[model samples]
Target chain A: LAKTTQPISMDSYEGQEVNITCSHNNIATNDYITWYQQFPSQGPRFIIQGYKTKVTNEVASLFIPADRKSSTLSLPRVSLSDTAVYYCLVGGLSSGSARQLTFGSGTQLTVLP
Target chain B: SAVISQKPSRDICQRGTSLTIQCQVDSQVTMMFWYRQQPGQSLTLIATANQGSEATYESGFVIDKFPISRPNLTFSTLTVSNMSPEDSSIYLCSVYGTGLNTEAFFGQGTRLTVV
Candidate 1:
């Protein structure tokens, strides 16, 4: 398991791009960086994942440098509904079983009007 | 992606009572996890439930306080016993993907309010 660090909170206006960065200086070779979004009364939803470089999805994009020490999640054209807490986690599967996931205090993004 | 249905979406329970949260996955999975989220805080791993075996609990969480049952691949339950005001939080269920770099899917969490 790798520990992750993120900003405590961020404020963004609607229609703006929001980038949340996570630092995992001790990330292992097998570790993958994953981001999840959680709304007020709902479960966390997987937003994006990346092993290296960039990966884009319908909801967000992930950027990872060659060192894999850190990664960023970019949400384009944000809306008020996108205001939520985002979590970044680094881990790898062990022996084809799902390993325990440790979550740190996430970055709380507040999308303003 | 997995579709998880968790029962008792929200409940207000009395102090000293217990509440059971049920998780049902649409498909079979190798691992099922339970997590607790305090208000305005992040999530904490409570336990990992594997079918046909004892659940592995995390540190600071005891089996006596939070017992888990995984009778099959698609179903599991977590019981919070001897509840108190401090026990009020959101409990979530999650399942891991089979691929090496796959993401995990989560269920709509259960909001337990011990009054």
Candidate 2:
């Protein structure tokens, strides 16, 4: 399993674009980057997943450089409701069974007005 | 995504007692896993429950302390044995159901407060 490192916390104003970067320098070729958002008292929700280059979803966009050493999750026009902890996970979608994920201490994002 | 429900969403238990948390999925799943989350902390994998076989526990967790059962594909249970203050945490169960691009779904969680 690959280890991930993220900032302890970050603050941003509402309506501004916020980007949270995660570093997984030792990522393997088969490893994929996934981001999850979690709110208080609730389970974490799947945000977006990517392998290389860029991947966009309805909620956010993931930017990965060619080196794949790090990835960034970009949230456009943040709101107070967007305040939550963001986790970066590196793993591959298994071919036959469930791929276990290890959730490390994630970056706590606070969206301020 | 599958809809999951757990029993006793929150409970307060006495020391040395045991509490069993139940997990139910709307559809049959291939894999089920249990996780423990301390307050303001990241999640820790407890074990993986498979039907008709014993659960595989992670390091620092034992089957005797956190016994698990998977009677079938749609349901599973986790028991917190000999509860103490250290066992006070949120226990969540997740399932990976059948599909091409499936993701794991988690129950609301069981908040166990042992005193």
Candidate 3:
């Protein structure tokens, strides 16, 4: 599993855009970048995933540079409800041969009022 | 996407006792995993439940302590035996999505408080 490094905490106000970056210098060729959001007392929810470049979904966007050493999760129009822990994981996606997902100390995003 | 339901959403258990957490998935999945999240800590993979065979546990976790059972493709159970106060944490069940480049889904998690 590729080790990831992220900020311990970030603060932002409502309607602002929040960007959290994760560095995975040992990322493998088959590894994919995935981000998850975890609210208190609930399971972590999948936000976005990408192998390279950019990928966007209904909730957020993932931007991976050409080097693939790091990736950023961009959340638009932040709200109080967006206050949660954001985790970035890098792992292979091959069925039956994929590596286990190892979570690092995630970024705690506090969306202030 | 897969929907997972975990039983005993929250429980307060006595030390030296055991508690079993059940995980049920809406659809059949090939990969089912168990994770432990200590308070104010990141999630740690406990084991991978393999159907029809013994589970594959992660380092620092053992079957005697966290035995896992995957009787079928869509259901599994984890037993925390001889619990201690140190075992207090949220236990989550996860399943890999069906296709390639997909995301894994997680259960609401079972919060266990050891007293």
The candidate scoring highest on DockQ is 1
Ranking by lDDT: 3, 1, 2
User: Which residue segments of model 2 deviate by more than 4 Å?
Assistant: B97-102
Q: Indicate the residue-level lDDT of B5 in model 2.
A: 92
Error of 2 at B84 (Å): 0.3
DockQ of 1: 0.69
Q: Model 1 over residues A1-113: C-alpha lDDT tens digits?
A: 89999999999999999999999999988888999999998998888888999999999999999999999999999999999999999987454767777897899999999
Report fnat for all candidates as fractions from 0 to 1: 0.67, 0.33, 0.65
| Model 1 CAPRI rating | medium
Q: Pick the candidate with the highest lDDT.
A: 3
Candidate 1 per-residue lDDT over residues B10-99, each given as its tens digit? 999999999999999999998899999999999999999999999999999999999999999999999999999999999999998667
Question: Model 1, which residues run further than 4 Å from truth?
Answer: A93-95
Residues A1-113 of candidate 3: C-alpha lDDT, one tens digit per residue:
89999999999999999999999999999899999999999999999999999999999999999999999999999999999999999988766443468899999999999
Clashing pairs in 3: none
The candidates' interface RMSDs, in order, read 1.7, 2.0, 1.7
Which window of ten consecutive residues has the lowest lDDT sum in model 3 chain B? Answer: B95-104
Q: For model 1, how many clashes?
A: 0
lDDT of each: 0.92, 0.88, 0.94
Q: How accurate is candidate 3 locally (lDDT)?
A: 0.94
